[model samples]
Target chain A: MKYLDEYRDPELARRLLSRIEEIAPGDRVIRLMEICGTHTVAIFRSGLRHLLPSTIRLISGPGCPVCVTANEDIDRAIWLAKQPGVIVTTFGDLVRVPGSTSSLNVERSNGADVRIVYATIDALQIARATPDRQVVFVGIGFETTAPTVAAAVKQAAAEGLVNFSVLPVHKLLPPAMGALLEEGNLQLNGFLCPGHVSTVIGASAYEDVVNRYGISCVVAGFEPLDLLHGIYLLVECVVKGTPQVLNQYRRAVSRDGNAAARRLMDEVFEPADSTWRGLGPIPLSGLRFRNSWRRFDAGERFSMPVIQVREDPACRCGDVLRGLMEPPQCTLFRKVCNPQNPKGPCMVSGEGTCGAYYRYHTESL
Target chain B: MKQRTVQLDQGSGGRATHELVKGLFVEAFRNEFLLEMNDSALVQLNGGRIAMSTDSYVVDPVIFPGGNIGSLAVHGTVNDLAMRGARPLYLTAGFILEEGLSLETLEQVVRAMGEAARESGVLIVAGDTKVVPRGKADKLFINTAGVGVVPPGIHVAGQNARPGDAVLINGTIGDHGMAVLCKREGLAFENEIRSDSAPLHDLVRQMLEVCPRIHVLRDPTRGGVATTLNEIAQQSSVGIRLLEEALPIGEDVAGACELLGLDPLYVANEGKLLACVPADEAEELLQVMRRHPLGAKSRRIGEVTVEEPGRVFLKTRIGGHRLVDMLRGEQLPRIC
Candidate 1:
């Protein structure tokens, strides 16, 4: 905890706030977007929004990995769990994610073989443990998680485990950002890019977004100051009418993030038309295992039927994710859906905006 | 006469469990004081000072390295009192036992509680117990309430934190959390990540003996340092800045957290306490803390400030600052 505590120095943080107040003088409405779940949680958890001047608004973005996972994809994973001799391995967050009619938890209650695994290696180990069963890892999340699953798929391929495969609903984040900017629902002035994702895709991946949108993007660590500094930098950019992607989390994120991991991801996955929860299907926004690894693809191995599902009658997760609505704004937020009995994907995951708001901000509301 | 009995879930309420207090607790711990046996206890003290605290213990795998839920109940309650600069004096233990829990295990936990109370120089003179059917309780659950008397004229509370006060920690954070996590997750490792579940009131006592005007005191439990600091910040209406390097995280824990994608700052700890002291007194307090076994690795980690009220900022070793948010949702259920 040595080098870690200084960044939390309240005095320094205060000084930075003053500096920001001075730099961004007058009533200028500066809207900066932080596109990471960690950032969003930090903002709410620490009451960071109150620290900003009235003119500055921190807008939430589609940064949560769980929030973006399409319902159909969740249903597809649930479908695999129902099949005989099929074992579904996934992250803890995915278990509670609502599908069309049910979730993996519901499936588990109904006697399905669904297990939560911390790493892809765990699934590989599971496949090794139960040779008679087909272990399918529901690969979700963005680039930070994809490489590990890609590695697992490669392992399954090399081992020639006929029973092991990955249902890769893996997403690429940059493309989605572009799609969001094009839609122009909110005039996003700047971006507070995710540090962990940056650790995979590097700071440069955001360069085009800066150039195209003429907005500043700061790759920030999940730390409060890193975020505030990123916002400060963004404010500076808007004031100067100059847009660029700046790397503030230098220790972990670089211009080129973990190149070796990125290479592994590229080697395994090819662009595919993947569906997003709120955004629908964006072209080449998702990944599929390469043709060479087709044999190791769980989507191909399992006969999953195409299905359309309706959102819960009252949930406003789509609007919540789009920053169009807050948790209290949702009719079912604390009523029909809660931490104990989540009705939608937004209420399930810990990183879900609605879930965070429900647990912490409900008292204030 | 009260006899050994089973424990029931709190959800079952006052009935079904047949838990009726006989006023033994009120008699043993009080000296011509505390007359009634109402739903809550009321005590009046001489004009010195007072501190009151409540805590619950529901540790699964029930027992582990260093301690069990019994000693933990004592430690947790005592520590809460300690945070307010109060030397703990009395404690009450409440139990909710699953129907099938063994008498042997129950005795062992009680013995632990007794030993911890004895060591911390506190007494558990009050008690309650209830029994629930199978699946209603997780082996055993304990809730403890404690009261302590502060010295003549010392003011200590969450709201006392002032800007520029230094933040100090007693030893490392997250051992208890990682210990529970590894065991709960069935993660085997070469090194034993045991829980740091020991009574911290003694450490609190030592700290106060060395310096009385400690602005703020808290043991970062449950959601870890992140949540605790946020609470303190809101209460104090101030900001807390932490030096990433100043944090005392164990190497194995760092490795384990990184591997598991868990944040150590947000991980729970049972034995550690965070203190916000005068900037000048932080180093001296750390020196005093180092002399005690509980705070052998105690160091100054951060400082309180007035800049951004109710925020916890983490400055990394490499000079980049990030906001350390309190865990919004439960990280791992039943970690305690």
Candidate 2:
């Protein structure tokens, strides 16, 4: 709690809140988007939104990897789970996410040998232990998680674990940000970049967004103080009409990010056009195994049948992820969808915008 | 499509489990005793009031850091009886063993159970054992049922909680949960986390002596402090507001929860108990609880409120507040 407790000090938070209120312009409404699922949850968990000035509107973007993952990819993963002698391993976040037809949780209950692992290394270890069975790891996340998966893949290749393979659905943060700006309908004043992802890709990663869209970007940590400070920085940028990339989480994020992690990612994967659940297909927004490591790719290793993907028409998860609609605005928000019986990934994943809103903002609604 | 079957989430002691219980078990077994829905059922037997409770232990890796499944089974049942201000007296245990389990492991488990029962001043009055094929059951499973005598003038139930009642918890949360998780997953940290799997009968006894007017006494076990508090809130039709800074959590457990993307409030605790007492008597009860070995780290976590009836809120470390909803399913780790 050494590093964390200090950041959560009420005294410090009050000072920062006061400072933000003083600088925030009262003439017009200022809209800011937090493009990270973790940030969205953190904001809600701390009830920070209620404390912020009403004029500054914070919107949740498609930062949750689980929420943005396309139904086709989930269907593909479900197909792999059903394969004979295959053990499908995935992060816990993806197990409850519904695919086109079924979910991993349902498959598991039907005895499909599905396992939830905390890290990719655990999947590798499972593959190493069970030589007779094939282990398909469903790799999902942004840059913050891709390095660890890449490291595991490299370790698997070095150990020559032929039974181990990955369903690479890893996404890049900056490309999605670019896509969001290109769509040009969010009408955002500033952006609160993810801290962990920024640690891997750095504050410099958002320079392109700021340069291209002339939007203010502030790299932020997940703590209350970090978020408030990040908001104050963005507010300053908005007041001065100067769009720039700033780093408020200097302790964790650097300008250039972690070079070693980037090197590892480049060695194992290359940017490929991938489909996002809400944003549709974006060029170079996802990572795929390089030719050298292609053998470890589950998509290449297994003979997968073509999957017909479908989305629930009633679930406005696409609009929710795009920051076009709030969770309660969806017709199925708490009526047809909830944490107990989620109709979309936004309600399934903990960090999903809808899930966070439902968990923290239910009373207000 | 496959026929609907029981998934692991149904046993997670969260929303799914609640639904399954209400939709099936409670509907079929509708009775006044079952309707009360306290941890243990209070029954009048032989012109005397007694607490009756039953629990089953199927924890994976039967042997864990602080205790084994055998000890856990004993503690679980004994604590349930103690929750009703009952002096746990007798217990019954049933064991389902897998065919290839070593006799040494079985003996160790049984011995641990015996020791725990003895420590809690309870006798293993009756028991049975059965064995299944290697894959039919896990290494071992234990089911325990217990009965205890409730003293006169002692009235404690979840529904007894009222507005202006103070909520207090003994020691830290998330120890047992994190310990089991780390041991099972082979996750190592700088400091090893050991499970807080101990009987709370002695502590509860001490607490009642100081304030027999204790409103509610329930162990924050499976779905943890959060879920247990939610149950109390709904049962009593009052709101509970927890102080984020007041909730005591072990450093190692906190670190592990942070690493695993788990909330300590929702994590399980084997030996912890939540007591709701009249606001004025709270400090006296806390003083008594702190004298007991198990309650040395006790703190006043929250207070029952009239606002937002049947809801629980947390006053965050910052000057913000958020609703602490019941666990939806199992607490799943987040993707970074």
Candidate 3:
């Protein structure tokens, strides 16, 4: 509560809001896109958009890992989970994600040895403790989490974890971001870069987007004021005709990111073409185990690639992730895909854009 | 709602889960105030005005260390109404029942709700029950709406925390969230973790008597104190700063949060109130709160500032400053 209560000073927020108003006094319709699932959830749940000036529109992008995760990958994870003598280790969230007709949760109920873990280090520990078990780590998430999983895999190899393997579903943030721009699915002016992901990928990752797409990018922490400041910086950049990556979260994120972590990631994995949920396969958007770590790679060791399947016909998660339509516009939003009975990834993942809209958004015209 | 094979998460639409809400929950404590059969409560203000509030509870496992959803529903509803400077009065309940629930489990929940109401001196005057068919609803979902009469002299709102105002929270945070996680995850501890779920109306009433102009009274529930303070800052359009070392967190909860890669400040709490008041009234209010069981660990954590308004900043234990943002998405889904 020490470093926390002060930033929430209502008077400070007013002053900041006033400053923001003065900085962007012109009646300009600014559309700022936050390219992080975390920021989208933060902005929506806190009703930050409701409090913001109507002129500023917050558009969600391909931020959610699960949202962008391809259908084939989920089917594959499900397939691997059901494999005999294989103990699938995954985050609790993946268990409920719908994969074709069955999910890991269903597989578990029907007798799959799937264990939920908070970290890959735990998975390595499980592998170390259970020599007879083939503990496959269901690797997911973007840069922020990839390095840790990389470190875990490196440690596994260094420790000679013969029975350990990783189902590498790890993704790269920038490529997915570029895919968003390439598709022309979103109209955006500037971007609020992700903080945690930036910690691994570095602030420079957004430079490509800023240079190619002419969008101002500023890495931001998840705090309300931090977001406001990031927005203010982006608006300032747009106003001044400047386009570059700025680090608003200097404490955690650096220009070069964690060097040791990056080294581990490089040693363990390489870029490869990967499929996203809404967007089709983007070249080099995913990470896979290097040849040296092939034995620890679930894809090669388990003799399976991600199952290719069509996206659910009823789910409009694709449009939602692309920022083409609001979640309320979706046919299954509250009717068939309510949180209590989720029918899609958007309704399932806590960080999904649709879930964010449903929980915090009020359908006010 | 239709009857179906009772399976975990199944016919909440009308199987075992439905019978629990209608037969056990509705049967035991059904009342007129909740039977309006409207989308929401329609209360006619008798005096100058009435204070109304909405609270949705999704705390998972539906039960925890010292309490379950039953007591949580009672305390959470009463506390929300009390924060508006109202005499905690009546509440209406809506439940999302899951499938395959047991009869004995439903009885325990209803009985707890009754006990909580009797202790808080409030009634479950009106209510509606729905079945989601099993596997659809998580055990049960309770949404409560309450109406209270604000006293003539008492005035409280988040927008009133001015510069030179003092900020305080009841006891520690992360306790309720951690306790629930401990029980649900089957994590064993040296001592049993317990939920601090108790109605704050009595404690709030005593505090009002001492400090009638208490600017804000809020239970830091789902988003914990970090989220609650963020709400207050934005509402009051004021800046807030707090000392980190002064904030309270139970040792076990802190440990669990660290282990789970979660910040305790961002976790949920079933029963915790954050009171923001002017500096001059801080001492007396603290004394009054201390006299009550709920506020024993209550202490002044921060102050309101005119500069940098609408931000919650904290001086860390490491002698650093950072922004404390409101929790964005569900840290843990189905958690109240």
Which residue pairs of candidate 2 clash? none
Candidate 1 residue A58 C-alpha distance from true site, Å? 1.1
Tens digit per residue, CA lDDT, model 3, B6-35: 344322111233334456555777865343
Best by lDDT: 2
For model 1, the docking class works out as: incorrect
Q: Which parts of model 3 have CA positions greater than 4 angstroms off? A: A25-28, A305-308, B1-336
lDDT score, residue A241, model 2? 97
Q: What is the C-alpha lDDT profile of model 2 across A1-365, one tens digit per residue? A: 88888888899999999998998778899999999998999998988988888889999999999999999999999999989999999998798888888999889888899998988999999999999999999999999889999999889888988899999999998888889888989889999999999999989999998999999999999989999999999999999999999999999899999999999999999999999989999999999988988888898789677888888788889999999999988888889788877899999998999999888886552
Chain A, candidate 3, TM-score of: 0.96
Model 2 residue runs over 4 Å out of place are A82-87, A108-113, A121-135, A149-165, A289-307, A363-365, B1-3, B186-192, B332-336
lDDT of 1 by residue, B1-336 (tens): 112333222111111111222245445566432332221222346755666677677777787766788888888888777777778899998999999999999999999989999988998988999999999988999999988887765666677799989998988888988888788778877688988887777777778887888888888877788778877887688988888767888877886886776778878888999888998888888888999889999988888988778877766543445566556545655656
* Candidate order, lDDT descending: 2, 1, 3
Report the C-alpha lDDT of model 1 over A71-107, residue by residue, as the tens digit: 8888889889999989999998888888788888778
lDDT of 3 by residue, A282-358 (tens): 99999988887777878788788546576679898888887788888999987888655677888888788877766
Q: Rank the candidate models, highest DockQ first.
A: 2, 1, 3
Q: Which window of ten consecutive residues has the lowest lDDT sum in model 1 chain A?
A: A356-365
Number of the top DockQ candidate: 2
Top-TM-score candidate index: 2
